[model samples]
Target chain A: MKEPGLEQPGIAVEVAVPVRRTPLDEISRVKMLACQAALGAVIALAWQAVSGRLVDDYFISNPLAIGRRLVAWIGDGTIFVHLWATLYATIVGFVIGSLAGVVLGVWLGVSRFAARLTNPYLLALNALPKVALAPLFVLWFGIGIESKIALAAVLVTFLVFLNTFAGVREVDRDLIDCARLMKASRAQVLSKIVIPSAASWVFAGLKTAVPYALIGVVLGEMIAANRGLGYLVQFSGAQFDTAGVFAVLAVIAVVAMLLNWLVEIWQERMERWRIVSR
Target chain B: MIELKNVSKRFRKGDEVVEAVGGIELGIRRREIVAVIGPSGCGKSTLLNMIAGLYPPSGGRVIYNGKVIDDVNTSVAYMTQKDNLLPWRTVRDNVALPLEIAGLRRAEREERADRVLEHVGLTGFEKRYSSELSGGMRKRACLARMLLQGAESLLLDEPFAALDAQLKLVMHGLLLRLASEASQTVVLVTHDLMEAVTLADRVVVCTHRPAMIALEQAIDLPRPRDVINVRFTNRFRELYDMIWDCLRLEYHEELI
Candidate 1:
């Protein structure tokens, strides 16, 4: 026979423990930033010390020389013109390509027949090295920003498209059925359920596509262009100006990081409900 | 308001056809709380899915309000075994989802969601995401969402099967109070016999695979009953034992 209790039968009395709520804090942001800055300083100091002694300055330009080149370019406003050109192509191409990819991917994702029909063609296109099409894009769109934009758009499209397709396909079936039971229209299901559910994946695709967009634009500019960072790189390489090449490369790295950071911020804002702090 | 006429479901897994639920005939009256109790994997959930019209029955028809359910039945709210709450939405937003789908105004939706969240004792946790909630709290949120629908019927598939024993007791009290107050038709599918006896007006026991009705026993316990002390009563134990005896027979048959 089990002893009767207020809440449960034959259960031992549970000790009451008061829970203390405390705010969770990870490694301070300022500390992390300081560490990153220190690491960068250490690398730069090592390079500056070894330059012209252990290795020729022509091979790997000294950080001081690269900094001087960047300062000179900034003083003459040479950096801003080329920076703006590259930024414009990368941003515009990325937005257009991502939007188009989302539409196509979502459409194909929802339609099994359409996805199956275009599977082989999409796979073949994706498998093809997009960098190889740089010359062709320049020939078609010409040496202006159009060629760079077109090349970037093409590269971003395939990457975003594949991710969006997978994301849409990966949406939880149970969530869809739950919505359907709540009298959700097909459009409602897609907008409210499918799209939001696949948002993380879309963000992932966008994040990866950012660098690829820059790569595509730079490649196109390298193949044929009169302005932009790629042209600067090629011109400096031809002149054997290692410091100029390094400065331009450094700027490109910063731009890529800035674009990636923007995507991350957008993802965090949009997916506020997904708390990764477990 | 729900009727299943010879309901059957068979799933084709690769080349083999597995019959989940055999022909089942069951009619549930309006405002009745019916609990279908059976062994695990006895096709109990398949029956509820038919009522909710997730998928059409392989053999028979499921009738809701005198009309056969062919498409997804939006009239009845269903809470599957999984909470199925959208991970990207807060407790308030998740509770307001059905209303949002129905094109309800934001003010009206939030007001109703607030009220329902309070009713489910999730008053201050409205902004918390599903990932942050404990299992019991998530279940309550799901229940609040279901209640906010204001549907005439609710089909719950093992709704509280995942909760701890102490939490389960509390949830039972909460559910009994709500169900009695609202008087909505509820079809609860659970393998827990005690739970079936506690909240259900009638308990329907099902057999093994290709589940058929083995026993349908009415719980004659008085209303306004305390879920905690009710289990200690002689009548509750008798009902539990009776259902267990029938369920034990099914298990023995499965072994043989």
Candidate 2:
């Protein structure tokens, strides 16, 4: 019955105290917010000065006018259709590419024969410029969402595959020997030893691939698309509405940032037991 | 009970074949602690690996309890020189790995793991990761995991060789006590002569590369031994001199 962290011999109940933030921490946060707001204001004023009016007849529009246009577009369900088209393409491509990469990467890492046979092919594919294949994808899959998804999947697969394969292959050999001596079955060794050991690497691959998925979707739309944010940019540029183009670019930037933030949250949540912090 | 009869191991390097262990014959009785000592590249570790079923002998059989061990088995636990705890797992979960892999229920595994943790002086550190622990604590965790596996025999490959003198003595005491309680048959490989003398019931001295057993000596020290007391005894010096005689001759021959 020793008291915790004391020289007594009695049972003690410990209470966790919430951490108190200092004035310096509060000031730092406020400064960050102020800087962001200032930057946004400067951009808005610059757009107003360049456009010459709140609403233009044919040329570039003002920031306020573009905001109103966005509101109207959202109300008419146009934004929803375009957003859904891009999002659907990204999700489908990410799932298929990531799954294939993880499976093949692990297979290659564990088997010498597989690694030897596929090494040259993997290197040759990785060396090729992924963007150059967009036209081929369109020709093979048409101007539909399938072509866009296929392009995105190809871009993301290599990044994830290399990270996961290296992660598994670089595992501590001593741990493998220990598991083997304990009579672990091949399946158990893979699930319990190999997968958990390579989790950080897999997560690293996923983080890198998330950005690739967004880039793939945008690139696909840039080549040939009737909807999505990239299409919105094209439409605005064609009309000489620079403000509208900037606004659409801003939306894509925000979407990409939001996706990255979501990935960070997921990684942290899944790796609570891991040694390295996300 | 373990026996190695006419065992030989060879490895191919480039175009040449090099013998690692050559024509070795040895037997260890049940619950006996035997220490194998030799110079570097003497293939002591290779012999222990063959006994632990990590490798197969090229010429002869490794019989454990009258059964030839050719592949990995759960009956023996091998402690490597490097601590191999999973970084993701806490001390408790790491210790319970064998039980979990053997399909024991969670509660039962936890209970068994906790008991072993207490034995290793890690009762309050169940949630600590391997990264958070010091070197000695990590080594203790490795020992606790081996104990939780509940193997009848242990093959340790210079487990305490990396520790400083003080920590090595403490760990040696803990290991000897645990082995006594578990009634385990232990085969230890080490280059340290003092370590071989302290914990072993019998010592096997091996020659240089393409190694073979040179001499075997029995130690009849009392239990719950104190190193200070043992060192002061004449029997300690006698065993030390006997081991040195063989080691000195082997060392000179290799140089020549």
Candidate 3:
């Protein structure tokens, strides 16, 4: 609302504001989303057209058949059992691995002697392919969620550790010096400066570790498991059900994308200062 | 009051020994503003760091209030040229850091920080992050934090060298007023000869390397001097010329 008496004395005032122009970045973002959706639609249409005409449904599964199978599984509530199993293992392992990695990474990063001492052993463990160790994990933990959890933890740990180490190593020397001059205690320095400085690197490691967590669980399930998404794919493939395999793969893709979206939201919230400062 | 008795700092390279300052004796009286000026890389900064207790002197002792400092001296607040404000923190939070270290309650510290920010002409910028602020604004925030520390002394290393002429004058005026009001001692390391003459009660000129004091001249200018106006006077010009004369001798030595 405008004050009637505050207007220009002689001329009539256009109190109502004129239209505002949309920002360039916002316009470009909308155009990019539209292009992505259109591209996805084109791919689906081409797949549908080639389903029966060029390739048999028994061999390369049709998109429509896979969609119908997805609907059927959702309606019957059968996919939930396997999905919950894989999700439970992945989430549990991810939490444990991330906690251990961040804690150990910071501790070792701060302690020069300790990092030098454990250099060879940490390198050797990371040198071995995590997937190849799934069999050994299965042998040790039996054909249960324990094996999957172990595998996932092993995969996630190294990633978070390396990023955390790098973050700690490159901490701003000037800030640390300032904190010390302020008479900050050792614990104060750790809690106030070190952890907050390393938070971005830690979150980046967590985001990258998401797919590796899923891969670990799937690998363990494939090696030996009674129920999981990996087992679903294996069971359907053995029965020569290409449609079932494709449907399970599609479910995994959607699940991965959804989890990644959630993490991206979290990263945005954690780094809100960047938006304003920039 | 602070006293440096034959203080010197030396660093060892792989095989060579680099002497920064060599056996320089100085005393800073209570509530005095002393500026150390010289050519580039003359160990002026190293001398200030020792005074701040960021580094130990290789020879002799640095005594503050009649006590030798062995570690970080909380009685002094050191401000370098970089400003060194935390990028992730807002201006208010950055200024509140020293109070936080001192364990003041949140409400109490925030109120103090607010008053200091207002005094520094940054009243409405409490929500702005350090990265969002420009160079001069960030320097103001740093000054606010140093004020919050409320230490007995201030060790400033070219804190306004990066600023423009007009801004530097404004900063010099604010610093002089604040330091004199609080009766706090200040040791400044500056590359600008005019800045030394404008602000210091006494100016110490150091030689190029192994920085012994080349000359210690007192600026007998009137109190409460205007930074720009005082520069046009003869007293300020004479002090600047004297300091520059000592530095010019070193240039001739280097040429030889």
State the displacement of the C-alpha of residue B86, model 2, in Å, after optimal TM-score superposition. 1.4
lDDT of each: 0.90, 0.84, 0.88
Q: Worst ten-residue run, lDDT, model 2 chain B?
A: B223-232
Which pairs of residues collide in model 2?
none
Residue-level lDDT of model 3, residues A1-278, one tens digit each, is: 45587687787766776667766546687798998899999998898888788988678888888888889999999999999998999899888888888988899889999999999999999898989999899899999999999999989999999899989888997788889989899888887888889988999899999899999998888889999998898989999999899999988888788878888999888888877766
TM-score of candidate 2 on Cα atoms, chains taken together: 0.81
Q: What is the model-wide C-alpha lDDT for candidate 2?
A: 0.84
Q: Alpha carbon lDDT of residue B204, candidate 3?
A: 91
Per-residue lDDT of model 1, residues B1-256, tens digit only = 7998998999999999999999999999998899998889899988988888889999988999999999999889998888999988898999999999999999999999999888778999998898998888898899889988878788998888778898788878877777667778999999888899999999999999999999999999998889899999999999999889899998888789
Candidate 2: interface RMSD equals 2.2
Which parts of model 3 are misplaced by more than 4 Å? A1-34, A49-56, A139-142, B11-18, B221-256
What CAPRI-style quality would you assign to candidate 1? medium
Candidate 1 DockQ score? Answer: 0.53
Instruction: Give TM-scores for every candidate, taking all chains together and pairing residue i with residue i.
Output: 0.87, 0.81, 0.87
Q: What tier of docking accuracy does candidate 3 attain?
A: acceptable
lDDT of candidate 3 over B70-149, digit per residue (tens): 88887899998788888778899999999998899999999999999988789999988888888888988998899889
DockQ of each: 0.53, 0.35, 0.48
